[model samples]
Target chain A: MSEFLIASLAICGTFAIYHIALWVHRTWNHSLTAPVLVATTLVIVVLITFRIPYETYMVGGKWINELLGPAVVALAYPLYRYKDTLKKVAAPIVAGTLLGGIIGISTGLLLAQWAGFEATIVYSLTPKSVTTPVAMAVTESIGGVMPLAAIFVMIAGIGGVLMHHYVFRLFQVDHYLGRGVGMGSASHAIGTATSMEVNQLEGAVSTISMVMSALVVSIIAPSLVQLMM
Target chain B: MEKVGKMIMHIGLLYIIFQFGNWIQRTLHLFIPGSVIGMIVLFLLLSTKLVRVSWIEEGANYIVANLAFFFIPVTVGIIEYYDLFLGKGSLLILIVLVSTMLVMGGSGFFSQWLMRRKEWKHE
Candidate 1:
């Protein structure tokens, strides 16, 4: 097979699968139907059943990943838009994110360690709360496997989205502010989307918390990994 | 037509910043990723009025809004680790879920407590 032809086919195939996943998410409105989860599964199934090489798929897939860099830079726009809110309630958001991030990282590291996973897996769990690009990057810097980091991030996102309401109710977190910060700091982009689905103020706060938490994790994960080792 | 052109042009600007961030990281040997450094640079630019939000707003929004689409290719890479996770997958899932529950509960209660305390002081 010609490389160029395979690349085009993979790109088109990815878009088709993603759009179908988006439609299913639109109709189902469930965490399980999230576009990322659905589309990734579809693509994986197609590849495995066909016995296609991952290198072949990545010929075109790398093009999409290239956008991730500029996309990360683009995150600054949302952070900029919410400067006022950041200023007004910066104390609570920062403190809450710090507290939860510490607890989350400690729990993840300790649990993964106790489970008898290797050093790499435990290190990968360190930055699992951040968005994918950042989490994967942090994982690499800390000498962990990127795929495992991505999987851990997926679990954090989908699980948080699914379990947030019950957790919030149990914790008696009635206000949108608290809920938003919790979701964004703990689960990153997916949790922000969940907050958006419920309320605008919640979404905005979630957005800020997501960025703030990413910043916090990026600064700390490497040393934390070093300490663990 | 012009609006779309402007958006694409803004993306070009951001791409330049991303490369610049890569250069900075290589020179400084920083642990943070180039993309994140670029994010911080872009944030500082907007806040300091060195770069106007209008220049990047539409392009950035379009990209971030479709963030889930970008995850497709990378997530598919998980196929590479099939055997590595076969038996241990469920255990990893349990660890992540429990950690997430702890984070949500801890963060939610902490923020609400602080918020209530601030409100009480105001009253």
Candidate 2:
């Protein structure tokens, strides 16, 4: 078998296992995010321990990452369709995103500082709430670790998924717009994805928030890092 | 011929809106993205009855419905970094997990507070 074909099968096999786990858990009224992340990490660990080079994994896995761009462009339709509600809350959406972005970054930096994490790691972390591409760029620009930024993005996603419901209840944030913006600003894409499962309004609002948060972070992270430097 | 023209016009206008949105962000010196600014512009146009919602619904819905599929390529890129993650991955994981929880909690609380303030103003 050709290398590409073998790599493709391995990728498919990984996804198959992920989906099967998802299905089994769903039957019991459970979620797949936590388990899938844990499982993926475990599998990766085993692969690494066995001395499997990451480049070999990329032969097939790169195909999946290429799809993110078009997916973002695809979001335009929902935003257009739901323009009315979005307009009604535009002020709040902008306001909420700004506030959320500042708080998310500042809080992370402060906590990391309090814990005595290295400055470079802290810089890598400041953009954790944004999506991967943007976060990676921010990290690189600020002289931080790109791989660490990617991991931080995933952590933000899973964090949003795990705590969003409880946070909403605790804060009495019942409105779709508020909930969505909060998720997007805090968790980035993963939070935005899970928001879609809740409702279209949440999804749309969260999408806007995610994009806005990334933009906000792109502008501010560099300056903030400069200040720290 | 007219329908095709209108379809072309619609796409053209959307592209313009997207560009204009970016222009506004740059012009205003805001921290937000041009696409988001475009979303806001489109939403404003729709809300004020300048552009009917039906006009862009088809294109907009098409984009939104399949947002998940778009991220597949990026996620696949994770496979490339598997080795780096394999070494000292625990420290990386710990940082991500802890910081994420902090971001979500902080953002959620702040949003809720802003919502309450908005409600108070109405009352």
* Winning candidate number (lDDT): 1
Tens digits of per-residue lDDT for model 1 on A188-213?
Answer: 87787666556556766777778778
Question: Taking the candidates in order, what DockQ does each have?
Answer: 0.60, 0.25
Measured against the true chain A, the candidates' chain A TM-scores are: 0.75, 0.83
What TM-score would each prediction reach against the true structure?
A: 0.83, 0.70
| Candidates in order, interface RMSD in Å | 2.7, 4.6
Over 4 Å off, model 2: A7-26, A31-54, A170-172, A226-229, B1-92, B116-123
lDDT of 1 at A169: 83
Q: Considering the two chains of model 1, state its CAPRI-style docking category.
A: medium
lDDT of 1 by residue, B1-123 (tens): 999899999999889889888888999987556876898899899989999988898898777766667667766876776665568877888898899888888987898799889989999
lDDT of 2 by residue, A74-174 (tens): 45656766777787777777877887777767766776776677888888888988977678878888888897788778767765666776766766677
Instruction: Write the residue-wise lDDT of candidate 2 on B23-121 in tens digits.
Output: 887799764556556766776687577988667655545445434333433443466655646655555556666656555555555665666787789
Off by over 4 Å in 1: A116-124, A131-151, A157-176, A189-204, A214-229, B119-123
If you assessed candidate 2 against the hidden native complex, which CAPRI class would it receive?
A: acceptable
